[model samples]
Target: MRATLIDDLPDEKLATAVADLVRPGGRWRKVDRGYTQAQQWIVRWPDGRSVFVKSGTDALTWGWLEAEIGVYAAVDAPWMPRLVASAGDGQGCGPVLVLEDLHEAQWPDPWEDTMVAAVVATLEEVHARTAPAGLPPLSDRRDVLHGWPLVARDPRPFLSTGLAGARWLERALPVLEAASARADLSGDALLHLDLRSDNICRHRGQVKLVDWTWACRGNPVFDTCAWLPSLHAEGGPRPERIAPGQPEFAAMLAGYFCSQAGLPPQQPGSQRRAVQRAQAAAALPWAARELGLPDPGDAPREGVPR
Candidate 1:
C-alpha cells in the first residue's frame, strides 16, 4: 500500500539517495518513461523545484548513462534538458544524473501539424550544433546501423520477419543494399540515432530531446532520415511529407529496422524487435515511393510502433 502511494519507493529512501542534490524535505517518485534500463525519478523539493534523476545500475545502462552525461556536460543547447547534477567516478559507471524535470512537458503521441513542425525545427537546431570532440563518427557505427548487407548475407532472419515477400526480397535487397552503401553519413553535426515520441517532448514551447547515448557525428540529414520512419509508425506524416527526396536515407532506415525485426530479442522482454518490424514496415514503402522502385507487394503491415 505504501508503494502504491509512492511509486514503489519510500520517500525516505529517495531523500537518502540524492541527499546532496536536493533539500532534505524533497520527495521522489519513480518515473516509467523512455526505454532506459536505469532507474528514473522525479523529485520535488519543498521550494517547488523538481528534478529528473537516473541511476546507472545495469552494466549496459551505465555505459549509455555515461555517454549521456558527457553530452549533457559538453553541450549547452536548448534542445536538451539542463543537466542539474551528477555523481560518480570519473569513469562512466555507478553514477546518477540529475536533470531539470520535464514532467510538465508534452509528449506528442497523436502528433499534430504544429507539433511536427516544432520537432523538425528542433532537429535543425540540434544539427546546427557541432558534435563534441572525442565522440565517434557516425561511420564508426555502420556495423550496427547498416542492415541490408546483413540481410544479403543471410536473408532468412529478415525474411522471417515478413516485411517483404521472398520475391520482393530477392529483387529489392540488392538495390537497398547498394543504396545503403551510397548513403553518405559523414558530417560534423550532432546526430541523435534514436528518435521517437518517447525520446522527445515539447517543453517551454520548444522541443527537448532526451536519450543521447546513441548520439554520433554524421550528415545532418541522417537526423531527419532516421526520424521520419518512427514518426509514421506513431501516426504522424509519411517520411516524404516532412523531408522529401532522400531515397538513400529511406533505404538505410528501412534496412536498419527490417534486419533486426525478425531476430530474437537482444534483451529479455524487450519490445524493440517488434518496434523495428513496425519501423521497417513504415520505411520500406517510403523507400520504394521515393526511389521509384516497384511497390513491395510482399511487404506486411505486421509491425508496431518503433
Candidate 2:
C-alpha cells in the first residue's frame, strides 16, 4: 500500500502544515486498514523522524478527525497516543491529524495474557483521570446505547442475521428489553467508547490508545463491558470470564450490536455490519448466559481481530 513518488499524492496542505517537523522529501505509505473514512499513513522524513498521519477522505471523517484532535489535546495520559500536529478544519482539504509513529509498536494478536492485563491496567488508570472539560457523560448515551428498543421498533434488521429465528426472537424479546432497561450507564470515569485491537499499540512498556474520536466519560465498568465483546470475538476470554457479572450491561451491549448487525453499511468499504454481527455473536450469548435467557442460536462469525 506504499504510495511511492510522494508527488503523486494530494497531501500538499497536510505536508505544508507539518513541513517543519516532517521534511518535504518524506515518504508515506497507506496503512490500508478498511472500516474508516480517513486515509492513514506512516510518513518518514528524510531527517529520519517519522509520524503517523490521518487525513480525512470525506466529511464524516473530517468531523471525526476534529474531535480526535480535541481528545488528544485535552488528555495527557500514558495510554494516550502522542499528538504531534494537526491541520485543516473542514474548510481546506478536510481535517488532518499528525501523531507519533506507532508502526514499530506491538499491536495485540492471539490475545496474549500479559498484553490483556496491560490493557486492563491502562484502562484502570484512564478511569482514574479527571475528565477534561466539555466531555459528555455516559447518561447522554443511555437511550442511544440501549439496543433492545431499536430491535423492538424494527425487528427485521436483527431477524435478518439469523442469530435467532422469528419465534426465538419473539420469545426472547421481553427478557432482552427488561435486561437492557435495567442498565444504567452513569458514572464519572473517563472512557474510551471504542476499544479494539487495531486502535491499540504497546510501545516501550506503555499501552497507547489511538483513534480518540470516541473518547468520553462513563461508568468505569461500562468501558470494560463494551470491550470484552470484541475481545471475545478475537479469541480472547468471554465477556463473562473476564469482566463478569454485569448482566444488564451485557444485554445492552448485545442489543446494540444485534440491532445493527444486519443493516447495510452507510458507506462503501465499511466493515460496520460484519463487525457488529461478530460482536453480536459474542455479546448475545454472553448476555444470555448472564441473564439465564433462552438460546439465541448462531451464525458464522466475521471480523475477527486483524
Candidate 3:
C-alpha cells in the first residue's frame, strides 16, 4: 500500500480520532523532530493530561503502524512506551496510535560514552527477553538482510557509481556473500531490526525502545550490529569496538547498505538513498577492517553520488 502523510487526514476525522484518546478540548502541538515515516504530535488535554499521537496515512506506513499496534498489545516491557489508544480502518484511511507522552525523555547522544554504554546494555536486555512465537521472520525482509547476495552477484551498482573502494567491494563480494551465508541470524529473540539512537530514548532513568514496526524474530545481536554504523557516523566508538568478534554480521550489513546506496532515489522522501549512502560508507570501514581489506574512507557523504 502507498504511504500516507498526516496532512491527508481531514480536520473533522482527525478531531474525532484525537477525542478517542484525549479529552474533547485537547489540542495537538506538532513535535519538531524524530518523525521520519509518520506524523507525530503532542496532545494536551484540558484536564492537563498529555499523550503522543502518531498517525500514518500512507499504505506502507499504515501497515507498519498496525504492526506496531499488535506488538505493543502483545508485549509488556517497561522499556517500551505505553500504548494508550488507537484508531484505524484496515482500508486506506491509515492508523493513529496514541501513546503515553514521555515528556522528559531524551534521545541519547551517541558521542557520549556513558549514554552509548547505557543504550548497549538496554539492547542486551531487550535481546534477553524471549520473543513471543509467530512474529514475522527477519528472513522475510529480503530488502534488509538478504539483498547483499543479489548485489554481490551483480556489482554494477557498486562499480558504476564509482563508490569509494569499489574495487575492494568487487573483490570482497564473494567473502562477504560467504559471511552472509554463514552468519547465524536465526533466534527466538525479538529483533528491533532498526536500532538507531533516534528510536531509543531515556525516560526517567529507563531506556525506552520505540518504533516497533520493524520488530521481528531473529538474532538479537543483529540489532547491536545494525546500530554500530549510526554510532560510528555520529562520532561514537567504531563498530569494531562497539561489537567485537562479529565480522560476518558487519559484512552482511555492509553488503546490505552497499546494495541500496547506489540505487536511484526513492520518491516522496528522496532521502532513502542518502540514508543508505551514509550507512554504507560508515559500515564499509568496519567490514573492511574486519575482513582485512582496504579502507573505503567515507566515499558517499549522506547523499546521491554525483
Please tell me which model should have the higher TM-score, number 2 or number 3. Answer: 2
Please list the Cα RMSD from the true structure of every candidate, rounded to 1 decimal place.
4.5, 4.7, 4.6
Clashes of each: 0, 0, 4
Instruction: Provide the overall lDDT of each model, using Cα atoms, as 2-decimal numbers.
Output: 0.79, 0.79, 0.73
For residues 1-306, write the lDDT of model 1, one tens digit per residue. 001114555344335557765545567788764345677778787778888877766677778888888888889888888888876532333667888988778888688899899989889898998999977899987777679988877777777766666767777888888888788889999888898887888887978898788888989998888988889988999999988989888988888888888889876766688778888889989988877777885454443323
> What are the models' TM-scores?
0.88, 0.90, 0.86
lDDT of 3: 0.73
| Candidate 2 local lDDT, 1-306, one digit each (tens) | 112223235467666655644456577677766667787878786778888888887777787888788888888777887888776652266777888888778888777889888989888898898678788887888777788888887888787787776666766778988998888777777888888888777999999887888778878899888999998898888888778789998999999999889888978888878888999989998888898877676433332222
| Model 3 TM | 0.86
Task: Give the range where candidate 2 is weakest over 10 consecutive residues by summed lDDT.
Answer: 1-10
The residue pairs in collision within model 1 are none
Where in model 3 is the C-alpha error above 4 Å? 1-10, 32-35, 88-92, 153-156, 159-163, 298-306
Clashing residue pairs in candidate 3 are: 2-59, 3-58, 4-57, 4-58
Q: lDDT rank, highest first? A: 2, 1, 3
Model 1 is weakest, by summed lDDT over 10 consecutive residues, at 1-10
